[model samples]
Every structure is written in C-alpha cells, then in structure tokens.
Target: MNKILIIDDDHGYRDVVSIAARKKNWEAYTSPTWRNVQHQIAEKKFSLIIADYRLRNETIIELLDYMKREKFSFQ
Candidate 1:
C-alpha cells in the first residue's frame, strides 16, 4: 500500500486527511511538530508528504532546506 505523511499542527486537518487516505487504502501518518516529524521521516519511506506551508516551528522553506541538507529524498 502507498504510505503518506501529513504534517500539520491542526488536529482537524490531520484527521480529515487521514480519513481520506484510508478510504483510498493508503497508509497515513501525521506529525504535529518538526522535531518529532524528522524521526518519522528517517524511519519510514513515504510516497507523499503533505505539510502545512507555515508550521508553528518553521516555514516551508526551512523544512525543505533541512530535508535537502539531510538528504531526505521525497522525489
């Protein structure tokens, strides 16, 4: 099954996305903060990552740069 990661602080949004993904038979995971999210990314491979453009901890650009520096291949 396809795996997906949904990064957002909003619980409602996460729930909605998770439910949607489940309907499509995809494995869905969520992380509310960047600190915890990094471990998830390192531990698993995701087919898609849906993140909020503005996180409470960092902006999307910062997150992208961190992913690039860590060599986390999303593509």
Candidate 2:
C-alpha cells in the first residue's frame, strides 16, 4: 500500500486529496498541525508528500529542506 502524507492547513484541500487517494485505495494521512505532522513523519515512512506551496509557518521549499536535512527519503 502506498502511504501518502498530505500537509495543508486548508481542511477542504486536505479532504479533496484524501478522498482522491481513497478512491485509488491509497492510505493517506493528513497534517493540519505542523508540529504534530513532523512527529508523524518521523515515526512513519511516507511514499510521497502533498504540501501547500505556502503554509502558515513556512513555505514548501523550507519544508522540503527540513525533510532533506533529516535525511528522509521516499520510495
């Protein structure tokens, strides 16, 4: 099963992606809170990430940088 991490502050956006992933039978997890999202990512392996270009706390580039710095990889 493909594990997908969706990072978005917008509830509607998250729901839309989650519903789409569900239709494809993929396991999708949503991250509304940035802090908790980090913990979740650290604890699990996600095949892909769907993030908003702009977030309340940071931009997508910064998020990608953080993931890189942490040596997180996707398959």
Candidate 3:
C-alpha cells in the first residue's frame, strides 16, 4: 500500500485531494500547517507528498531543507 501526505492551509483542497487519493486505495494523510507537517514527516514514512507551494508565509523551501537535513525520502 502506498502512503500519501497532503499539506495545505486550505481544508477544502486537502479534503478533495485526500479523498481522491483514498479512492485509489492509497492511504492519505493531511496537515494544515508546516509545524504539523514536519511532525507527521518525522512520525511516518510517506510514499508521496502533495503540498501547496506557499503555505501562508512559509514556502516549500523549508520543507525541502528539513527533508534534506533529516534524510527523509519517499518509500
């Protein structure tokens, strides 16, 4: 089974994408903020990540940096 994480400040967007992913038989997780996203990433191994390019003021660069620093990878 594949696991997918969707990060977005918009609940509706996350809900829609997560629903679509779940319909495909994939496990879907969602986080509304960068802090929570990081927590989830540290707690779980995700096969894929779908995120908003810009979440409030924080950009995806922070997430990329965190991933690199932690050696996080898709599985």
Q: What is the TM-score of each predicted model, taking all chains together? A: 0.88, 0.86, 0.91
lDDT of 3 by residue, 8-52 (tens): 999999999999999999999998866686877987889999888
Go through the candidates in order and give each one's C-alpha lDDT.
0.85, 0.84, 0.89
lDDT of 3 at 48: 92
The worst-scoring run of ten residues by lDDT in candidate 3 lies at: 31-40
* Candidate 2, poorest ten consecutive residues by summed lDDT: 32-41
- The C-alpha stretches of model 2 lying farther than 4 A from their native spots are none
List the candidate 3 regions with Cα displacement exceeding 4 Å: none
Return whichever of 1 and 2 wins on TM-score: 1
- Write candidate 1's Cα lDDT for 1-75 as tens digits: 889998899999999999999999999998886667788787778899888888897777877888888889753
TM-score of 2: 0.86
RMSD of each candidate relative to the true structure: 1.4, 1.4, 1.1
Error of 2 at 14 (Å): 0.4
Candidate 3: residue pairs that collide: none
* Deviation of model 2 at 72, angstroms: 0.6
Model 3 RMSD, rounded to 1 decimal: 1.1
Residue-level lDDT tens digits of model 2 in 1-75: 998989899999999999999899899999865555887787788888888888887788877777888998776
Clashing pairs in 2: none
Worst ten-residue run, lDDT, model 1? 33-42
lDDT of 3 at 15: 98
